[model samples]
Target: MAAVTSKVSLKLMIDTESRRVVYAEAGKDFVDFLFYIVALPVGTFIPLLNQEMVGSLGNIYDSFANLSTTYLRPNVNKDSLLSPKAYYCGATGLPLHVPNVESSRKVYRCCRNVTLDRNETCSCGATMNQESKYTVLPSANNPYSSEGDFVKGKVIYMVMDDLAVKPLSTVSIIALLNKFNVKEIGDLEEKVVDLGRDEVVKLLKASLLTKTILTDVFLSVLKEEVNCQQEVEGNF
Candidate 1:
């Protein structure tokens, strides 16, 4: 018995068994000793505060998100994308085709780059050469009812946003700085840090994001530049 007691005492010191036992007993005496010691009111207050916050926030009623899951809400009305009465005129680029033209038999008239050869000329001397006229008829393609003359040199506005990248609103400056580097970054790093800490984090807004889809890279760049200039002038 004496030998066993001595061996256990020795093992306690070696393995921190004595400390573990003391800690367990101490913890039971003072429930949550670690949290009380380290977190103080935070541990006790969290659940209470969370309950209070949730209770307060629960009072906020939203027409959209607040609809009871048990009570099914009626879906809002949806409008059709294309309006039937609306008509739009886009650019006239298609060629006026005159098929079955014979070189020898008939006198032909040239109109708006369209030649009325023998096949196009009616027996009544009516020239079949079509001078393409723009019209505003309800169609699947153009639904805006835009005027025919509105096709030339129009400017468009666009926006781009993402998280991993800089905010779009701030991008105007950031992009300028990153691209042109009018001012060095080392100087602005502190300002950026201050903004990160204190500001509302309104993102950089990139405008006039010209999409070069299906366009040659070089041509797109020039076209985009032109578009940008036109947009600026038009806006101003």
Candidate 2:
């Protein structure tokens, strides 16, 4: 087994058989991680974490519109992506269609010819006459291409934990929490380190985590441990 550390706050113990982390340690300083985190949109950053590679930002040559829609959460009453106004397309100078809860089911005026079929591409062959009022965001040809790609200008807050190449370790994750200034009930640092692996899982489950670590990965490891124990008992 070899332990590897990076300039970033993450560290890992590599087991030659699986080439995966048997253990990990996260550092206290989050300035570097947070610097990169705020610089890109969540959609773009997710892909980078999964693929371990970056993609070029898509061309923002189209127009934007006030796409107001109901939020998916039942508790959220209403939300608006932009003002309830429409802008002309960059290429065609045509009025851009803003999507709303009602309009989502109806055919869009600008891309009317484009199919509603989810399987195929929706493109309108419009050639731009002049600069558009809207800011066009980049897009990818592959639907999943943006899994780990990074964009230069946009910023976002949340990210999926599983996308990380190696999820942060317990220590590292605690450091992250410390960085966030989560108020400790008592002896938080020492208590966390002293907990058994299973007890750690239970402790984490009981506590509310507003900012998550690699939840799926961490839970999976715990589940695997349970299964391994079962298998050993069966053999005996």
Off by over 4 Å in 2: 1-26, 29-31, 41-43, 46-216
| Tens digit of per-residue lDDT, candidate 2, span 1-236 | 01112222223332333322233343322222322233323233222233332333212201112223342343221212121211111322111111110112222323444322222222443422222233334366421111122332222222223223233345554554455454431322220122223332332232222233433334445558779999999998
Off by over 4 Å in 1: 1-126, 129-134, 138-140, 143-145, 148-169, 184-236
Q: What is candidate 1's TM-score against the reference? A: 0.17
Worst window of 10 by summed lDDT in candidate 2 = 94-103
Alpha-carbon TM-score of each model against the true structure: 0.17, 0.22
Best by lDDT: 2
lDDT of each: 0.24, 0.29
lDDT of 1 by residue, 1-236 (tens): 00111100000001121111100011111111111122221222222222333323223322323555556423221111110011112322111101111112123344433332322443344644444443455455642333222122222111111111121234454554454333533333110011120011111111112222112212233457779999999998
What's each prediction's clash count? 12, 7
Q: Which 10-residue window in model 1 sums to the lowest lDDT?
A: 1-10
